[model samples]
Target: MDAFYASVEQLDHPEWRGKPLVVGGNEARGVVAAASYEARKFGIHSAMSSALAAKKCPHLIFARPRFERYKEISLQIRDIFYEYTDLVEPLSLDEAFLDVTENKVGLKSAILIARQIRAKIKEKTGLNASAGVSYNKFLAKTASDLNKPNGQAVILPEEAEAFLEKLPIGKFFGIGKVTAEKMQKLGIHNGKDLKEYSLQFLTKKFGKSGLHYYNIVRGIHLSEVQPHRVRKSLSAENTFEKDLISLQEMEAHFYPIFEEVVRRIEKSGIKGRTVTVKIKFSDFSQQTRSKTLEQYPNADQLWEVGLELLRQEEIPKPVRLLGLGISNLNLTEEQVYFGEQLKIPFHISNGKG
Candidate 1:
C-alpha cells in the first residue's frame, strides 16, 4: 500500500487526487498519521507534528482517518496473499512477509509470485503495492522499500553481500537514530563496517541485540515467516490541541482514549494483564508507567489502573500527548502464560502509527 491512509482518502474523495494530503488531526499538537507523496515532496511524513507539517506545506489537505475502510481493504489484500501462500507474516495492516519457498500454485519463481500478488492487489483493491523477493526476511524487507508505489525489487543471493556492504548502517532495518550514532562513533558506518566486528564483540557491546545485528549484516536472518503471529497489545492515544496543565484536565482526555482501547480489546477478543500509561511532555520528553495485574483486567479495571498511574505522575510540565495500553496477552486458558512483556507503542491515528 502506498501512502495507505492518505491514499485511501484520495480514492474515496476524488477531489483530493494529485493534491498534497494528510490523514490525521489537523490540530496544534496532533501528529501526522500518514502523508501522500505530494505531501512528502514538501518534507511531510508520519509521526511529524501536524502543525509542523502545515508549516512545511501551507496548502496541505487534512482528512480524518477511516480505519474500518482501511481494514476492509487490508483484508482484501491479505486474501490475495492467501491465494499464493499460507506463510504470511503481517507486520502491520498494510505490510506483510510471505514465504513462497513452496506456494499454493506451485510457482517456482518467487519473483513471479510477488509480481502476481502485486497485480492482484491492484486489480482487486484499485490500489498499488510494492514487493521484494529474496531468500531471507531482511533482504526481502530491505528490497521492498528500494522501490516505490507499484514497483518491485529482487535481491539475488549472490548479490546480497555486495549489495548490503554498499548500504549505509542507518538504512539497515533495526538500526535507529540512536543506534546509528553509536555505530558511526565505533567506525561501523555500513554493512561492511558492521561485518568487521566479531559476534563476541557485538554481543558484548550491544547485549542480546548485537547477536541479531551480527547475523543480519551477513544476510543470515533465519527467522521464519510466521502466519499465526499472536498479537501482543492494542492501544490508542491522542495529541492535545492545547497542552493539558493539570491532572484533572489530563483525566478528561484519558476517558475517551480508554473507551477506544476497550472497544478495540473487545473487538479483538483478547485480554491482557498489564496496563501502561504514556505521557509526552510539552518539551517532547516522554515517560511511561506500567503495572502488571494478578489477573487480566477488563475495561473498567484497566481504566482504574490507568487513572492511578496518571495520579502518580508529577506534572511539572504540561502534557502534549497521552496514551494508555494493555499488554501481557493471553489467547486461551490452556495456553501457557509466557510472561512475555509487550509494549504497544502509541499510534498517531486509528490505522498506522
Candidate 2:
C-alpha cells in the first residue's frame, strides 16, 4: 500500500484525490498519522506536529483518523495475500513480507509474483501497492521502500552484495537515527565500511544486535516469514496539547491510558506480569519505570502497579506526554483475569501491542 491512510481517504473521497491531504491531526493539536505525497512534498510526514505541518503547507487538508476503516481494508488485503501464500508475515496494516517459495499459484518468479500481487491489490481495493522481491527479509524490507507510491523493486542474490556495498548505513532497515550517527562517528557510513568491522568488535559495541548488523551487511540474513508472530507488549500513550505542571494533573490524564492497556490485555486473553510507565518531558527527553509481579495481575493490581510507577517519578520538568504499557507476556491459551469491564468511552479506544 502507498501512503495507506491518506490513500484510503482519497479512495473514498474522490474530491480529495491528488490534493495535499493528511489523515490525522489538526492545525492546533495532535500529530499527523499519515501524509499524502502532495503533503510530503512540503516536508509533512507521519509523527510530525500538526502545527508544523500547517506552517509548511497552509492549505493542507486534515482528516480525522479512521482506524476501524483501515483495519477493514487491511483484512481485505490480507485475504488477497492468502491467495498466493500462507507464509505472509504482516509488519503493519500497510506492509507485509510474503514467502512465495511455495505459493498456491505455483508461481516460480518472485518478481512476477510481486507484480501480480500489486495488480490484484489495485484491482480489488483501487489502491496502488509497492513491493520488493529479494532472497531474504532484510533486503526485501529495505528494497520495498526504494521505489515509492505504487512501484516495485527487486534485489537478486547475484546483485545483493554489490548493491548493499554502495548503500548508506542510515538507509539500512532497522537502523535508527541515533545508531546511524554512532556508526558515522566510527567511520562506518556505508555497507562496505560496516563489513570491515570484526564480529567480536561489533558485539562489544552493540551487544546482541551487533550480530544482526554484521550478518545483514554481508547479505546473510536467515530469518523466515513468521505468519503467527506474537505481540510482546500492549501500550497506550497520549501527548498533551499543553504541558502538564502537576503530578495530580498527570495522574488524571494517565488513568485512561492505564485502563486502555488492561482492556486490551484482557481482550486478547493473554496475561503479562510487568507494567511500565513512560513519561516524556517538555524538552522531549523521556523516562520509564516498571514493576513486575510473580503472578498475573487483576485489574486493581495492574492499576496499583502502574500508579505506583508514575507516582514514584521525580518531577524534573513540565510533562508533555504520559504512557502505560504491559509486557513480559504469557502466550499460552489461557483465560486472563481482568476484574470487570472499564467505563471508557465507546469511541475512545486506542491500544497497540
Candidate 3:
C-alpha cells in the first residue's frame, strides 16, 4: 500500500484526492503518523511534528489516525495473501513479506504470485500495492521499495552480487543514521567499501551484528520469513516537545502513556513479568531500568510497578524521551496458575548413577 493511512482517508473521502493529506494529530503537540505523496513534495513526512509539518506546508490537511479502519483493511489484505501462500509475515498494517517460493497455488514464479496478490488486493480493498521479488529476504525487501504506487521489481539470484556491490551502505537493511555514520568513519560508504572489512574486525567492533553486516554485503542472507513471530514485549515511547527536568513534570507526561499500555495489554490479553523504563537525555544518551516480578501482573499491578521504576530515576540531565515496556512473558497454562499449587516429591536418578 502506498501512503496507507492517508490513501485510505483519500479513498473514503474523495475530496482529499491529489491534495496533500496528513493523518495525525492536528493539536499543538501532535506528530504526523502518515503523509500523502503530495505532502511529501513539500518536505512533509511521517513521524514529524504536526507543528513542524504545518510550518512546512500550511495548506496540509490533517486527519486523525484511524487505526481500527487500517486493521480491518489489513485483515482483508492478509486473507488475499493466504489464498496464494500460508507463508505471510506482516511487518505492519500496510507492509508484509510473503514467501511464494512454494505457493499453494502451485505458481512456478514469485513474480506471477506478486501480480495476482496485487490484483486481488486492489479488487477487494480498492487500494494499490507494490511488490518485490528476489531470491532472499533482504534483496526482496529492497526490490519492493524500488517501485511504488502499484509497481513491481525482481532481483534474480544471478544478479544479487552485482546488485549489492553497487548499492550504498545506507540502503542496506538495519543501517540507520548511527550505523551509517560509523561505517563512513571507517571509509565504508558503499557495499564495495564495506567488503574491505573482515568479518572478524566487524564483529570485534559491532559485536554480534558485525557478522550479519559482512554477510549482507556479499548478498548472502539466509534468514527465514517466519509468520509466527511472537511479540516478546509491547512498549510506547514518546519524544517530548520540550525537555523535562523535573520528575513531577515527567510523571505527568508518562501517566497517559502508562494508561494506554495497560489498556492495550488488557485488550490484547497479554501478560508479562518484566516492567522496563527507558529514558533519553537531551544529549541523546539513553538508559533503561527494569524489574522482574515473581508472578504476572494485571493493569493495576503494571501501574504500581511502572511508577516505582519511574520514581527511582534520578534525572542526570533534561529528558527528551521516555518509554515503558513489559516483557518476560509466560503464557502457558501452567504459568497462568489457575489450578491449585502442588508440591511433588523429587526422586533421584539411580539408573544414571
Q: What are the root-mean-square deviations of the candidates from the true structure over C-alphas?
A: 4.8, 4.8, 12.7
Task: Rate residue 59 of model 3 by lDDT.
Answer: 74
In the predicted model 1, the residue pairs found to clash are none
| Local accuracy of candidate 2 as per-residue lDDT tens digits, 1-353 | 89998999989988888989887657766568899999999999998887899899988888767777887888889899999998988878888899999999997999998999899889999999999889999999888988987898999899999999999999999999899999999999999999999999999999999999999998999999887776777777877767889889998988888778777877776678988889988777889998889998888998888889988857889997788877888885422221222221212223100
* Candidates sorted by lDDT, best first: 2, 1, 3
Model 2 C-alpha RMSD to native: 4.8
How do the predictions measure up, each by TM-score? Answer: 0.90, 0.90, 0.85
Give residue 293's error in model 2 in angstroms: 1.0
Model 1 vs. true fold: TM: 0.90
Task: Write down the lDDT of every candidate, Cα atoms only.
Answer: 0.83, 0.84, 0.80
**Residue-wise lDDT of candidate 3 within 166-282, one digit each (tens)?**
888888877887999998899899888988889999999889999999998788889888876766777767667677899998999888778777766776677789999988887
